[model samples]
Target: MWLKLNKTFFGTGTHIYLCAVYIPPLNSTHTADDLLNLEAEIANYSKYGDIALIGDFNARTGEQADYIENENNSIQFLQDMLPQDYDLDSPIKRNNLDILNQQGNNLLNMCLSSRLRILNGRYLGDSLGYHTYFSKNGCSTVDYAILSKDLLPSVEYFCTSDLNFLSDHVQISFKLKCDIKQYINKKDFNNNNMKKFTTYRWTDVSHGKMYEALNSDEVKNKILNFEITHFVRNEKGINEASKSLTEILDNVASKTCIIKVPIKQKKSKIKKNPWSDNELKDLKSKINNLGKKTKT
Candidate 1:
């Protein structure tokens, strides 16, 4: 299992935490305790952000018309392990199936206790004609996307597709309706546009020159005769006065100081790996070309 954290969802400041997991098949060496431990680990991250747990839990939920008994303890383990906040959702809902197996009963009991509504059941109605997983015996929906209550509104579509002909298990896709505009901040935009200048280094010679310029008869007279009334009588006027002062200071500094320009360094070439020679480079290039053609 792994947790993927996304700080930005479209343009909104909402955070989304997706926990992807896979429970071993019934015949595997892993025990029910292992599945319970995995659920506990997933629950630890749910408090940080909106959680969406999507995975293959090998439990045979008796939601299909031709339901057969499977001896998987995943459903019972998960039902006891998961927190009260999480909701189990699946495309396949109980309709044609008259009997509830151990897995189905455990899942149903968890939903009832948590007051969780299944997303597929809410949107797609009672039954799904298509199944997610196909086997020699029959087809069944073993994969699921369990989500937190807060994420339900954002869910747009949830269904299965048989696009991957190589695999028996069909892919399940879900769409979320995200509003991009909510993520942009106007204050950050204004801050980016604001101008900032670096302070000039003052040597002894430059300092003497600036002192002489400031003490000159013409410069002294300008400062003495300067009046606030010359500009408008508001915040804009104060800004104008500040701009004039800055201009005078800049002029003095330009005449006195020898401004330094930072030099840009040339980037050195990357040394090739000793093991990767011309033969490996040629092989990699051919593989990339083949991949590009396949994509097109």
Candidate 2:
């Protein structure tokens, strides 16, 4: 079995965890059964915050360029695994992108994130593609570098340069802040009493950039129009249900707020003597001053 270690290696909080996974090598041809297993694994693993599936998938980018047999089937494997909370980032179109047609090279290198926000429920792309490593035909490209949608806005730059002499494919690297603290804070905000008091304020402040991305008109429409289906089972009669925009939003909001409680110290029995007269007077004065400042 490929190893699946759970911990926040990049972000600060446990809410954002890095799920390091390694898939056992399979034949280079990429089989349907292999794809099915891959899909199941991804679905099982996606329960964690904004999953990022790194490492080789042994599939070619050509699979994404045009319809090949079983292409949607392959993508469906991944799509099914995505969290119900959000949509994965989609392919971004760039100017001067016709170069792919000129070079007969299709952008197969992909990075998917599910932390995307929806205006209407649709996801948007942030210009995802790959760079050529070399001019030669025998280039090797690492399979995938999926990201969480919420984390994509912070991406300063992403590139894969061609290494003509060292190897066929160029080495890929990206620079993004790995603020584990933020993730930890987010994780703790739901449970920490002190943090909860300030959580909404901090979240509003922090989400300025993230909200901008999700609130784009294009992004909102995509989310609103995305397809969904329902399956039902009944003993004697069957009732199928479908979710509307309002229903989906309400559901998502509820799930997002469900936080795990963190271990805490038992309340201390040690009690201070009733506040001294001077201390009480001083506290009263401070409170009055705070009230005055608020009025101002």
* Candidate 1 Cα misplacement greater than 4 A, ranges: 5-7, 11-14, 63-118, 124-129, 181-296
Q: 1-296 in candidate 2: lDDT tens per residue? A: 23333346455232443334333334435344544454455455557544444444433332232212344456666776767774334443332121332112221222212232111001122133443333445432333444555555555555544454434545544455556564465654454565333111224333454455456675466456644343344522222233444454443333334333444568979654685577787898999999999999
lDDT string, candidate 1, 68-108, tens digits: 22414345666777787754443333432223445544444
- Give the alpha-carbon lDDT of every model: 0.59, 0.42
**TM-score list, all predictions:** 0.44, 0.34
Residue 77, candidate 2: C-alpha displacement in angstroms = 25
Tell me the alpha-carbon RMSD of every candidate.
28.5, 20.5
Candidate 2: where is the Cα deviation over 4 Å? 1-10, 13-32, 58-143, 180-296
> After aligning candidate 2 to the native by TM-score, how far in Å is the CA of 70 from where it should be?
23
